[model samples]
Target chain A: MLQCSRLSFTYEDASQPSLKEVSCRMGQGRLTVVTGPSGCGKTTLSRVINGLIPELYEGKLEGECLIGGEPTTARPIYRLSEQVGSVFQNPKTQFFTTDVRSELAFPLENTGVQPEAIQERIDQVADLFGITQLLDRDIFSLSGGEKQMIAIASSCMMDPQILVLDEPSGNLDVEAVASLARILGRLKDRGLTMVLIEHRLYYLDGLADDFLVMKDGRLTEHLTPTAMRGLDGPSRQARGLRALNLDANEDASAPASVATEKTPDLLRVRNLTYAYHHDQAPALNVDDLTLSSEDVTGIIGRNGAGKSTFASVLTGLLKPGDRSEISLNGTKQTARERVEDSYMVFQDVNYQLFSETVEGEMLLGARRTDLFREVAQKLDLERLLGRHPNTLSGGEKQRVAIAAAILSGKRLVVLDEPTSGLDLLHMNQVTGMIRYMRSLGVMVIVISHDQEFLAQTCQRFITFRQGRPVRDSRKLGNLLQAL
Target chain B: MRPISIYTRFLLVIFANALIFLTLPTPLVLAINIYFCSFQVIVGRVRKGQAWLLVCLVFALGASLAMVFPENLPGHYLLFLFVGVGRVLPLVLVAAFMMGTTKVSELVYLMRKIHAPQWLVIPVSVLFRFFPTVRHDYAQIRRAMKFRGIAVTTGDMVRHPMRTMEYIYVPLLNNATNVASDLTSAALTRGIGDPGPKTSIQRIVFTRLDALMCALGLVLMGCGAYVAMFQA
Candidate 1:
């Protein structure tokens, strides 16, 4: 069992405690998902439980956290590793090795596990994660979702009593989330304690036994799965929480603009094809694809099924092969030309935020400053103008990237996985920004595996398979299930 | 079913690099050094050809200018740059190959096998992971610069030198600053500091290819030494 009582934490640099007077018990053989709006102290509470607060992050701690009823303070962080396995938010951050095989062996080898036994464990864990094939794969070469799976698999290889994952599903597709949920269920059946810090709710369906709601440094609300299931749409929305259950038959796909009439295609591509190697079949070989300024188009597919590659091609990051062409407003376009005409907000927004301050970032390459205040206010970035872009939270960084794109006066904006780690409030804000952009006749293309976000924001959908668009959909449920 | 031992590969790189720099028989040493590079590219699939570009740049502009106009002031300077830079490319090629092929964990495995101290092994392993990540981050930083309109071309650098430098370094520093802690934490969680016998999944077998590469390196070095002592 994982338990914390009267837990409070104040970060070294900050005056206010991030987690205040929080108390919770995660019973053994149970899954507890702690979630809330951004900066709600869910992460802080998790860190305290995992013994990183005073142990790693220099911070004041009050009250006590016990893993398996023993004070976390009783053991060193490395000693606690035997009892609890943790996966952090950024999958890229925790990895120490260059490839998957060594990443798995790292923990085992550290604990002085026998060589043959380590290999046995690696095989067992790989089989469990359904990633035996990925053991030889390069860590840097994996997709965001693949990296997340490997992160989980690496953590689980220790076979700790408690598994604590911070937003493991954020980067995952529906299929991958289902797989994770199944794995968590199996681990729970084996009497392991599971504490998941997740933003998405739909995938946890029957797996989560309890939900802990943290709000502004306090564990304000706790609900059983039954009570959580009773939350109506408006209440959940009001609380800034995702749907407990979205109706399968709901038609949240087509945007209102699409109902009115069709708009002219602002972007068009003919015979778009790209391949990494000479011998391999093209990862992408689309004959023709078009997007109109009328609605926000969502590109939905599996994690590495070429959605991001398609975005790269569209944004002109990846140049198209010969005998292939791209055009904007009937004008033939090169990669540089396309890049000049468009902005792509990468999934990891860290790369896009270059300016020291938010205001400085907003002022970059802008034609007009009149709309700056309104955009900033709409994206909840007004309060962050004085802050360094590097110091902003993940959601704030994402918003800053979006704000940067908005300020750049680009004709087209492509957002790749913008809502992956964003909470409900920020998701709504991002969806609103996309709508605002669409209303202003700026063509927006969103590449994401977030079905619900797509259901809310996107009017048109294109599903890809083996790097080519297999079909178009106006229904997100089908897209979610199809993969 | 068997791959060459990582330690054996590292030894070959070190020995071959030593021979190249010794210049006992300059041509043979150069051939041996370049062969190791080609072996990495073709067999290990560690293809980083920018080192080749460096060689071309040094030889084409520097060496050719020196040869064509040896008496001229510009030729003298070019010759100085050529001789200074030309000798370093072979070693750089070998370093790149070592980095590209050997992972941090493999290095750690070899270090423990040789009973290296933890402090040395840990940092060395960390450094093996560091260079590749720096290269990746550098690319991202460059891409971000281009997208953000602070393109670091010669013209832009000349115009806004400080801003261009800021654009290049600040993002990289900020991005990788916290990576140290993350790496430390990851290493800790894995029980890296434990004073215990470390184990690895890699089977360190001396393959035929390994034997062949070692033999070739030793033979070339021996021939170079013989020529250096007696013939030269």
Candidate 2:
């Protein structure tokens, strides 16, 4: 079991504590979920449990954290690692190896485990995760979900008593989340105490044993799975929690065809194909498609399904094939023109935000500054104008990017996974921004694997498979099931 | 031929480093580059090895062309630039082959077997794993720069040097900072800092093929050294 008693921590340079007297006890063989809005101390608590608190990030720690009856305080991270295994949010950063086989063998190798015993453990863990085929594969070739599974498998190679997963499903799609739930369920059945820190709650409907809600660096509520499931919309919203239950067929009746037809200004494309290399097949091949400038369209696909490639091509960051055509309202536009007319907010907003201040970022490469004040006010970035882009929260940085896009006179804006790794409050904020962008007559294309964000924001859905749109529908709920 | 041992590759890399300074005969240089091209092909970098081979051929041709020109002829400096980079082309290719083919586990095991300190082994392994991620992040940063209408051209750099440098370095540094901490956390949590003898599942002993490759490298180095000392 994992236990925390009056835990509070402040970073070395931080003025305020990230975790404020947090207390919780998670039972063995049960999966306890820790969830809250951004900066709510859930991650800080996980760090405390994993012994990365005072060990790695030097902080003023005032707490008692125990994992499997062992106090985490005063112990080295490696010693605590023997009791608690940690899987971080970002799959790309956690891995220290280049191949699956080596990654699986890493933790064992570090602790002076014998080569033969390590190999045996690798085989057993791989079998447990149903990842035997992935044993010999390169880590880069695997999908986001597969990489995450390997991370879990590698962490479990030591057969630690407790497992801590921080937002493992942050980058996964609906199908991947389902697969993750199954894997976690298997781990729970094997009597491994699990702590999952996540904002996505629907997939954990029956899997989670308890839900611990934290706000303002304090544990606000602890509820059983039954009570968490029974939370109404208003109650969930007040707690800043995501929907506990996601029914794909609940509201499948709203067809977007009517709105799409009413909008006269449409961006049309013909035979649009883009290949990363000459000899290989096209990564994006949309033969014929029309997008309404008034409708917020959601592009849903698995990782490497060309959703991002399509966004790049559409935004003119990438050139299409020779026989392709893209026109706005019957007027053909070249790639250069498309570049001037569209802007894309990348998945990692850190890359897009180049300026030091929000104000400077808004006018970074703009041709006009007349809309700057209005866009800033609308996005609620007025008071944050002087603050550095690096200091702002993830959602604030995204809004700054959007504000910059709008101020630059862009009519088409693309947000690639804007709400990923974001809590319900932030996701709702993004949804509201998408609606606001649509109201301002900007065509929004959101490339996402987040079903809830898409359902709340987009009017039409385009599902891509094998580098092409296989299903274009208004019934997001129905299309989600198929995906 | 099967993949050669990483020890062979490491020996060849050191040999190539020495060869870079020595004024080897032209034919010997060409032969070495060709051997490395084939070595790369054996190691599954089919296209990269061939591309480097083609580049070396161009460099050799350009170097010969410059040799035929007068001492102070026009375009001689440009040709000389190619001559310099081209002279070490084979070494660069060898280094790439080593990085591309050698796994982190193999390298770590090799270091441990050699009785290297943990401080040296950890950083070297981390540096080896950091490059590919940096490359990926750099590609994204360039795309983001293009999307934001920041010109990523030489002309733009010359005109707005500070802004261009800011555009490139800010994101790169930010990602590096984040990845560094996250990577350390990951390494520490997995008992990478345990004060014990570290073991690895990777089998990293030299094979018969490695002996052959090392002998070849020694012979080549001897020939190059003889030429540099006597002929030059």
Tens-place lDDT per residue, model 2, A27-94, is: 98989999988889899888888888878889799868876667898677887898889998888888
Output per-candidate TM-scores for chain A, rounded to 2 decimals: 0.92, 0.94
Candidate 1, residues A182-265, lDDT tens digits: the string is 877777887878888978888888989999988899998999999989987777877778876767416544456743233555
In model 1, what is the error at residue A47, expressed in angstroms? 1.4
- The residue pairs found clashing in candidate 1 are none
TM-score of each: 0.89, 0.94
Candidate No. with top DockQ: 2
Q: How does residue A136 of candidate 1 score in lDDT? A: 91
